[model samples]
Target: MALTNSQYETIMREYEDRQTASRHLLEERTAEVYARVEGYRGLCESVASLSVSQGRKFLDGDEKALEDLHASLSSLSAQKKYLLRQAGYPDDYLTPVYNCPKCRDTGYVDGSKCHCFKQAIIDLLYEQSGIREQLESENWSTLSYDYYQGDDLQRFQNAVKECKNFIKTFDSDYHNLFFYGTVGTGKSFLSGCIARELIESGHSVIYFSAAGLFETLSRNMFDYKNKDDIVSFHEDLYGCDLLIIDDLGTEYTSNVAVSVFFSLLNQRHLNKKSTIISTNLSLEDLRNRYSDRVFSRITNQYTICKFTGTDIRMLKKRLQNRK
Candidate 1:
C-alpha cells in the first residue's frame, strides 16, 4: 500500500506548516523581548558603532587610540552585562530565541540530538497520519463495557480484568498482543488506552493503522523525491519503545508490503520489543493473508486477546443522534 505522490506532498506540506508555526512563535517572542528590554535598541546601535570605530583605529596604526577603544568596548560590554543582570535577563536575552530554548530550536546542539526536535518530528509524523485527534480523544476512563450489550457479562468482565492486569504490568519484555474482534468492538480502544498510559509514563509509542503504516513505509522505500529517508521509518518502528499496528489485514496486501511487515515484526520480536496488533481478522484470515512464518512468530512471541462485544460505535452514534 504505497502512498500516492499527492499524499506525500500533503504530508510534507503539513511539516512545513509546523515549521512555519514555530517560526511565527519565535518571532512573537522576540518582539516581546524587544519591548521588555528598555533601551535595547539604543544599546545595540551604540555597540555596533563602537565596534566599527575600534576597527578603524586599529587600521590607522594608532596604538593609543586602539588601546582606548578596547577599554571603551570592554566598558560597554560590562555595562550591557550589568544591565541584563539588573533586568533579570539571561546572558543571551538579546539573541534571537526559539520556543525550545534548550537547542534554540535548531533541532540539534553540539553534535547531539535535541529533545524538542525529536518530539517535534514525532508530533509531525503523528499529525500526518490524521489519527492524532481521534486517538487523543480516547481514554480508558471513557471506555465502558456497558455498550457491549447482549454479551455474557461474566466472560466480558473476565476479559476486561485480564486486559487491565496486562496493561498494568506492561513492559518492554512483555509479550506483544494481537487483538481480534469484529468491527466497532473495543479492541482499538483498549490498545489506545495502553498507548496513552505508556506515553504518559515517558515511553515513546507509535500507534498507526496497518494501512496507514504500510502506505507510509512503502512510500519511503519507493519514493525518492522526498528529503525524508526510509531508514527513518525503520528506525522509529524498531527503535521506539512500543509500536502498535491497528486494523491489520485492512491494507492492500502485497508481496512487498508483506515482506516489509514481516521483517519489521520479526526484527522487533528478535529484539524483544513490544507491539500490539488489533484486527477484525481471525487466525485463519491472518494465516491466509500473511506468510506462515509471520503467523508462527506472532503466535510464539505474542499474546492473543479476544474482544467480545457489539458494535460500540453504532450505539454511540444512536445515542448522539438522539441529542
Candidate 2:
C-alpha cells in the first residue's frame, strides 16, 4: 500500500486547504462579530497593546509593570466575553474550527502522523489494492466449515482456531504463518481471513500476489525514474502491521526477485513484523527454488500450516452444477 507521489501531494494539498479554510472561517466570524459589537473592536485593540507592553516590560525587568499589564489583559478578556455574551454569541465563536482537534488540521501530532493521517493512508490503500471488496466476501464471518470434509474439515477447523488465536494475541512478538499446499485448498482464503480480522481491528495489512510483489520490486530496482516510489513501496512492505503474499511460488524467480525476497524476509523477521505467505509449493520445492538461507528462515520463523484434500473451488463448482 505505497502511496504514489500524486497521492501524497493530494493529501498534503487537502491538509493545506483545511488549514486555510479554518483561518478564513475564523476571520469571517470575527469580522461579523466586530461589525455588530461596538466595543468588541476596541477590546481586541487594547488586548493586543497590553501583550506588546507586557513583553517590553518583561525585557526591561519591570516586574510591577508586567503584573499590572497581566491584570489589565485579564480584565479586557472578561469584557470581551461579556460583549460576546450580550451579542448572543458563544465565548469561542471566533475560534478556528479544526476537523481533527488532535492534529489541529496539521495532519501530524507531536511530529508523528495523527490518526486521521493513518486513516487517509488506509483509505488510499483500499482504493489501490481492492482488499476491501475481498474482505467483504472472504472474512472469517463468511467462512464455512461445510466446505471441508473429514480430514480436510479437521485441518480447516484447526487452522481457523489458530488464525483466531493469532489475531487475539497479535503483537510484534507474534509468529509469521506459512500456508502451503495444492492449489484451491483454502490457503489464500485462510490468509485473507487473518488479514481481514487484523485490518478491521485497526492494524495495517498489506496484501500482494507473489507476481505483483516481485514485479513491484523488480520494476523499482531497474527503473531509476521513480526512486521515491521505490522507497515508499519498500517502506510499506516492511512497515505494515501485517504482510500477506499469496501464491508465493507463482512469481518469476529472477536473481533480483530472490535477493529482494530474502531481504524482505530477513528484515521483517528482525523487525518482529508478522507476515502470512500462501504458496502451492511444497517444503521440498521451496528449498529448491529459494536458497537454503531463505528456506531456513521460513522454516525457523514461520508456523507452517499444510493444506490437503480435493480442491474446494472445484467441489463448490460441482455442487452448483448439480443444483
Local accuracy of candidate 2 as per-residue lDDT tens digits, 184-302: 88888888788777665557688999999998888888888888777777777887778899999898997778988999989998877899998999999999999888899999989
Per-residue lDDT for 204 in model 1? 61
In model 1, how large is the Cα lDDT of residue 52?
Answer: 86
Report lDDT (Cα) of residue 251, candidate 2: 89
Candidate 1 runs further than 4 Å off: 1-130, 149-159, 224-228
Badly placed stretches (over 4 Å) of model 2 are 1-20, 31-40, 50-92, 101-130, 172-174, 200-203, 282-297, 309-323
lDDT of 2 at 320: 96
Per-residue lDDT tens digits for candidate 1, residues 1-323, read 12334434554465456567777775775576567767655765787898788788878887777778778878877776676777787766555545566765555689765776556545544544344666686767786667655554554565567567766776624668888877877778777777666655545677888998899877877677765556556666776667889999889878888888899998887776788898999889899989988899888878787776668789789999999
| Clashing residue pairs, backbone N/CA/C < 3 A, model 1 | none
Best by lDDT: 2
lDDT against the true structure, per candidate, is: 0.71, 0.83
Candidate 1 residue 248 Cα shift, in angstroms, is 1.2
